[model samples]
Target: MSSTLQDLVNRAVFYSTEVQTHFGALIADAEWEVDFSSDPHLTFTPADGAVLRTRPHLLGSESDREKTWLWGWENVNDFPDAIVGLSHEVRKFGAAEEVSELTTPELSLDEELALRLTLAAKEATHKWAHYPAAAGAGTTVWLLVDAAEIALPAPQVKVSVRALMQGLTQTTVTDHRAAIESYVAKRGIPTAELPEGGLRMLFADGSADLSFDDQRRISNCDLNAPLEGEAAEQFAAAAESTGTPAEAATASRTSGSASAPAAEETAAPAVPTPSAPAPTPTDEPSRTEPQPVEEPAAEAIPVAEPKPDEPAAEAADASHEQKQPENEQPRADESVQPAEAATPAEEEPAEEAKPKKKGLFSKLFGR
Candidate 1:
C-alpha cells in the first residue's frame, strides 16, 4: 500500500513528541535566536549563562495571513543549499512514496498543517527534533534541528505516556490507537494486545493500559502506578488546555481542508544532490551543568539581509568553511542551573515534602 502523509505523521508524532518534550525542558528558560548566514545555527541562551547551539535545516514556512505553507526547497528567499538540503530529501522521499503533500510546493494551511508536515518530515528523514521559528510578516519558519543535547535516552513508560498526553493538546490526532501502536513499535517499547481491544505497554518502571472506543479513539488510559509530581501536573495542565478529539475534528472541518492547494503548481524544483561530507572528529565534550526551567519560544533573530549585489558563490564558499563539526556539541543540560536547584530551601513548601500518588491517568477521558 502507498504511504500517505497521514501515515507518516501517525508513525512519527508519538516518538517526536517525546523527544520534543525532552528538548523543550532542556531549553525551557532560554531565548531562541537564529542566524541563517553562510552556515545556519539556532542558539538558546538561558539566564544561567549556559548557551546551547544546534544546526538547523529549514523545512518550510507557514504564513498565517495567507493561510499557506511553502516548502524550503522553493528557496523563495534564496536560502543556501546547506539550509535547504534536507527538504530536498523529504521531497524525493515523497516522490518515491507518491505522497502528494510532500511533493507539493505550496499548500493551504490549517491549524495542524505545519506540525503535520513537520512530523511527516521527521519520519522521512529520521530527524527527531524540530522548531517553529517566528519569522516576521506573520510567517513561521519550521526547522528540523540536530544537536547532541536534544537526543533522547531509552523510553520510559511515564515519560512516554506524559508526552502522548502533552502532544494531544498541540495537534489534532485522527486515530489515537494507531498513533500509540506506531509509537510503541518505533520506540521498541514492549506491548501486548489485550483481549478486550486494549493494549498494555510495559516499561522498566511500570506499565500503562490503553482502551479504545468503538471508533478507535482513545476512550481511557490507566496506569499501574499513578503519576505524581511534575509529570502529573504537566499532564493535568495539558488535558485542561485541550478540547476533546471530537471538538478538534469539528473545528478542523470549519477551518479548511489541510491538504487542499490554493493554486496549481507548475513543477517542483529539481532536488539538489550534494556530495556527502567526509567523516569529521568527535564533537566537543558535553557540558556538565544543570538545565533551567524556562522553555524557549520562537522569536526572530536579527540578521542583516544580504545586499542585492552579494555573490552567491562567495556565500556558499563561506558556508563550506564554517560548517559545524560532525560530532555532538556541549548541550545546555551540562551547564545551566535547574529551577528547583535555584530555589532557596527556606521557600520550600511542606506539602511538596509529602509522598505523592504514583498514578495520574486513571481514566484520562472520563470513561
Candidate 2:
C-alpha cells in the first residue's frame, strides 16, 4: 500500500529451493516484451482472481486481439503450477542435478527475491554479500524487527529479499523495488528508461527483475551460520583450544611484574639500635661509672713542720704563772700550751669533742 513489494508479501511463505533456482534463471534468460502504444491496467481481486487487460500479443480471436486484455484473479490458482513447471524446464538449462530437481511450493518467491535483492544491493554498493549457492542449502533469512517501525505482515504477502533488507535497514517493511520505481517515476533516473509499457528498467541485455506485486531490493550479505547459531560456538571452541601453557606462564609473569614494586612501597621502615653503631673512644665515658670528688682532698695534704722548744725564760715564766717558782722550768712547757699535746691520753677528749661538734653542725646545716 505504501508503494513497496514488502507491502504485498506475506511472511507465511518460505522460498523453496525450486523457487530460488527458477527465479535466478528467469532473470538470466527470460525475454519480456512491452508495448507503450496504450497503457494497460491489470488487477487481482479476491472474487475474480487475477485479471489482465491488454492486447500485447496476437490472439486466436479477432476480438481478443483487438481489445484490451482482461484476466481474472482465478488465474493465480494456476500460478503455482505454472511457476513450478517453469522452474523444472529452466533447471535443465543450469544442468546442476540439485538445481534441476528443485520444487516450488517448498520455496517462497517473496523470500527468495528479498535474499537476491539484498545480495545484489551489496554487490552494487561495493560490499560483499554471501548467500547459500543453493536454495535448500540450509540457509534462512532471519529478521530482527524494530516494533515501532515495521508491523508484521498478514498471511497474504510473501517475504522478499528487498523486503528483508529494507526491513533490516529502515526498520520497516515494504516493497523496496516499488518504492524506488515510484520515486524514480516522479523524477526519472538519467541513464535508465521505462520499458515500452511496463513499470521496470529496460536494458539492452535484459530488463531489471521487477515484479508488479512482489518487488524486492538488496541490503547485505552474511554467512548462514549466524542464523544457525553454529558460527559463534565454533569460534568460542577454537579460542579455548588455542590457549597453551606458554601463554598461561606469560600471563602470570605479566601480572606478577605489575604488582611487585607496589608491594615493596607499602612495607614499614626498620629502626636502628644503639649497640648496632660502631664504638668510638668519645663514647667510652658515657658507658663508665663516675668517680667520687672527696678522695682527692685527703691526698693533697702537706707534712706539718715541728716547732723548736720554747726559751728557758719563757718556759720558766709559763711554769711560775701556774703557782710554780719563776726560776723553775715550766712543767714541760705545759703552762704555755695545752697539756693534751704533750700527753697522748689527755688528747682523746679534744678529738672526741671536735667530732661531736662536726656531727651537730652536719645535722643542723645538712652539709
Which candidate number would show the highest TM-score if scored against the true structure? 1
**C-alpha lDDT of residue 300 in model 2:** 18
User: In candidate 2, which residue ranges exceed 4 Å CA deviation?
Assistant: 1-43, 46-83, 96-367
Give lDDT tens digits, candidate 2, residues 1-367. 1212233222211111112211111112111111212231111112223222211110000011122111111112122232122222322322332321121112222313433322222212211111111001111111110111111111111112222221222113244444444323321211122233223322111122232332343222221211113333332333355553322311231111222111111111110100111222233111101111111111112211122221000000000011113342122111111111010122355546532111110100001
lDDT of model 2 at position 162 = 20
Prediction 2 TM-score vs. true: 0.14
Per-candidate local distance difference test: 0.53, 0.19
357, model 2: CA deviation in Å?
99
TM-score of predicted structure 1: 0.61
